[model samples]
Target chain A: MINWSAFVVVVVVALVAAGVLVTLFSTALRVGDGDAPWRRPVSVGLYVVCGLVVAFGLYLIIPALHAG
Target chain B: MLVVALVIALALFFDFTNGFHDTANAMATPIATGALKPRVAVAIAAVLNLVGAFLSTEVAQTISGGLIREGPGGVQVTPVLILAGLIGAIVWNLVTWLLGLPSSSSHALFGGLIGAVIVGAGIGAIDGGVLVSKILIPAVLAPFTAGLISFIATKIAYSITKKRERDNFKRGQVFTSALVSLAHGTNDAQKTMGVITLALIAGGLQKAGTGPELWVIVVCAVAIAVGTYTGGWRIIKTIGRGITDIEPAQGFAAEVATTATILASTHLGFALSTTQVASGSVIGTGVGRKGASVRWKTAGRIALGWLITIPASAAVGALAAFLAGLGLWGIILDVVLAAAAILVIFLRSRRNRVDHRDFHLPQPGAFVRPKKRKKAVAGG
Candidate 1:
């Protein structure tokens, strides 16, 4: 009965954790003398796609009894 | 009785590792900035950490109740499960230490525990909602909050001191360093208390829902304190000097940022990693300051280790748990593995002796002291 929901939840949580952490650390990401949020460019796309996949997997995999 | 002893031993071992693993959080900045002599800083930090460990066990209560399922059958924790986790966590710590990567010891500990629980008792044994809502939320939020706070704090520090002299700012580093150490004690040492308490509950030595006993708290605090005095120079060197150039103000800012975040989390019974928060704050300070470079390569290695520590330790824990189900031989095996691991770690650390004397010195000529002009700005 495991589905994408649990996986989604996991990915979403991880992404948020990563995102929030990275964003909070945004002030620390500036390359010497650089002010642009370089992390934004890669962070958004990377988190979205990866987050979805991870979430889907968790949703699917975690609900079952331990068959392993 | 033996099970209780083993669990207590495991908790102390974890506490010992926490003390060594997390020494940098409290001392790195001060050492880097020469605010306190390396030995002096660690010695002070070690004592305060012990004091802090005894201050509260709210977080320990949470770990006992929040992370795993508990009921009339008692805590449902097994010595083998905990031993497995300890093994996993120790291995991860050693590997990371060898590579000089600073990672979150908290996560490794959590990961090992969860992994063992899942493998041994099944997923039903976990409190997933609590995992996501409480521990996970803080774990993810804390470091970033620390980073942001450090960023703003650094900026504020920069402008206010823009008219001051530098020595005054360096002097300030000493106070902030002390706070970081105190905060480190409050946060990291409690984790050991929680684990040990969990073991006690599982072993029926204590009430299922109660906190650690006064004696248990004292022993863990002392063990961690001694471990703190032992020094985590590899991580200290890497964190203090490897990531970026930190000045007196930046060091103060990072410490303050770290302190605020950890105190809040601990109060709420959240099990976040002080090391991660400290690193993030240090990195944030680097980004806030001009001309500071974060060593991305080192950061990347640490990130990779962080990714693996949980799962890796969990696997080891699970395997250990499975074997422990075999009885006395399993305990014997766990003991051997532990003894061997300890000898290896002891031997490895001796390869490069970093005493209290050289704890603050950067690798010759590579020291990152702030410039003289900035000193004028800080003091004037």
Candidate 2:
């Protein structure tokens, strides 16, 4: 039997992640150029979050991380 | 032992072609957007591919164990059979590369293997259920899904900021493209590892269901990495500039969508083609942005290439298997013929070379003589 559930889950997760990441990164770029006092901190936070996502993605690829 | 060695060599060569052939998948947009220099982009992709290869063995295991059947009732795939299939794949890959088409290397491999198996060991060797569920299903779905995600993402990105400074988006592209390269390494390099391990198992040097050995992984990684460093500039030109005019923001969106889709598919044990995913995302981003016109003609050509890749490569695989089945002399003849064909393709490519140095120039269309005439006028 095909694991259709896994396939659906992958599709959903990837779509959500791609949407969220693009929005977040683009917003961060917008905020960085704003004149508001809080813009700098908010942009920094978003960049940090993006960095963490990339780091986590890299970590997941390491075989030992998933191995029991 | 000699035949096993030959199979391993061919597998590595396939890996090398896979590396250069698919470099466009991760780095094309970045190069197009000037987010990274051509050479620097390929260098980064090469290193990430090497590092990424060490990250997972799941895909390798899938290739070595799950795709083909073993035992008395199943089709027996010997090392010679594997070699013949690889020759088919390599020939197809080189032909497509010479034509500047970004077809799927994954499909070429699958088609070649399946075709050789049918000719050499009969259709019973294939797991039809796995083929449909795992390989075929994902192949059809992944690109559309990736395209949709990228399309939505690009719209959202443009909506967020109508005209922002591109520097930040270019910076973001560097990261997203790196992620795509890493995901590519995790997926594509493992295919070669799987093929080599399959050959080893067929030769009785390894257990039937085990993952590739450490040495096999290392050699495959190095081969692919070296190939990545070489850069498939022709395909890069096609993906980066031929299909659509891409800005930095669009590049970032496309790369992120591609990375997400490839990683997700890899996690699910689906061997999707990175080339198709990347191409789909590029086209999707093109459609997402208002007033951005995708070169529908070029997209159609790429789609046509994808449609033909499987059956065309399969035909060649079957033919190679038929010829090699004759005897030892036949195997030698196949090798000689394949080598001559490859050399002829290489020499022909020199007549109109596209390299990293001039990849950004307006490329000649498949049937356009005007560009060549213009070039001649300018030279004179």
Candidate 3:
């Protein structure tokens, strides 16, 4: 018995996550372009978020992470 | 014992081809956008593919235990049948690669196995419900879903930043493409592991319904990594330039869409084709852009290739299985014919050599209008 509901939920979540990640990455790059006072901190925070996302992806790849 | 060893060797060869054949799925957009150099991109992908192979065995378990049944009341799938199936898959992959078509290697393998099993055992060996529910349904749906997601993502990306440095988007493409590569390795490499594990079980070298052995994982990972590093430059050119001209932003969006779709499918233990997902995302981004065009003729050709891959590979598998069922002489003849076919394809490919240098070459039949001449006949 295939769980079609779970498949749909996962697909939606993946799509939203992709959209959000791209948006965030692009925004971080845009804000880091100039010497504004808020640029440094905002850029740093955004980069950290992006890095964390990647780290989370790596975590998922590790079999131990999913072990109950 | 000897046949089991040969089957293991052939499975690794299939994994190797699967690697180079699919390199374009993850790296083509990045290379097209100049986000990463061709050699550097492949090296990175190769390393990540190796790491990703060790991640999970869910897909392998599905292939070993779910697709074909064993024990009482189940049809017997012998090692010879598996060999014929692998040969069928390998031949189709090579032919498709030479033609620069991004067909589904996963489907080819599945079709080969199904064909061989039918001829060698019977249709009763296969679990039809699992084939449809797990493999077939996902194969048809994944591409469209990826395309739609990429279309939306590309549109949103353009709207947010009207004018920005290309370098920024290129940097983002590097990260996104890497994710796609990692996802590809996780998904595609496991398929070979599954086949080999299945073979081992049939040969009584391993227990039935067990996950792939440690050695199986290691060999499959290394074979795929080496193949990736070789880089299927011909298909890379087709995907990177033949479909549509890609900018860094579109590349990022496409790669992101591909990564998400493949990763989600892998999580669910579905052995979907990464090639289809990547192609769909590429087409989706092309449609998303305002003035960009997708080359319809090339796309049509790819679509046609997709439609026939399963049946064509299955036919070859069935023929090979029929021959291999005759015993020792039949097996030797099957090997000879497979080798000869591969050799011919390899020789023919040398006539139109495409490599790293030709990655950016203008595709044949690209829309180039003739230059206008002065209108002397008009008597201005």
DockQ (C-alpha based) per candidate is 0.02, 0.57, 0.43
Please give the C-alpha DockQ score of model 3: 0.43
> Residue A43 error for model 3, in Å?
2.1
Candidates 1 and 3, the one with greater DockQ? 3
lDDT of 3 at B125: 82
Q: Which of the numbered candidates is closest to the native, going by highest DockQ?
A: 2
For all predicted structures, in order, the TM-scores are: 0.76, 0.91, 0.91
Clash count in backbone of candidate 3: 0
Worst 10 residues of 1 chain A by lDDT: A25-34
Assess candidate 1 and give its TM-score to the true structure: 0.76
Model with the higher lDDT, candidate 1 or 3 = 3
lDDT tens digits, residues B271-313, model 2?
4678888999999999998888899999888888888887787
**Could you give the candidate ranking by TM-score, starting with the highest?**
2, 3, 1
Tens digits of per-residue lDDT, candidate 3, B1-380, equal 76788789889999998999999999999888777888899999999899888776555454534666755677667889888888889899999999999988887887787888889888888888877776677767777888888998888788776454434577788888888888778777888898888888889989987888898999999999999988888889888988998888889889888877777776765545789889989988999988889998888888888877877788888888999999989988888898898899989999999887775543342212122112223322
* lDDT of model number 1: 0.67
* Residue B55, candidate 2: C-alpha displacement in angstroms: 2.1
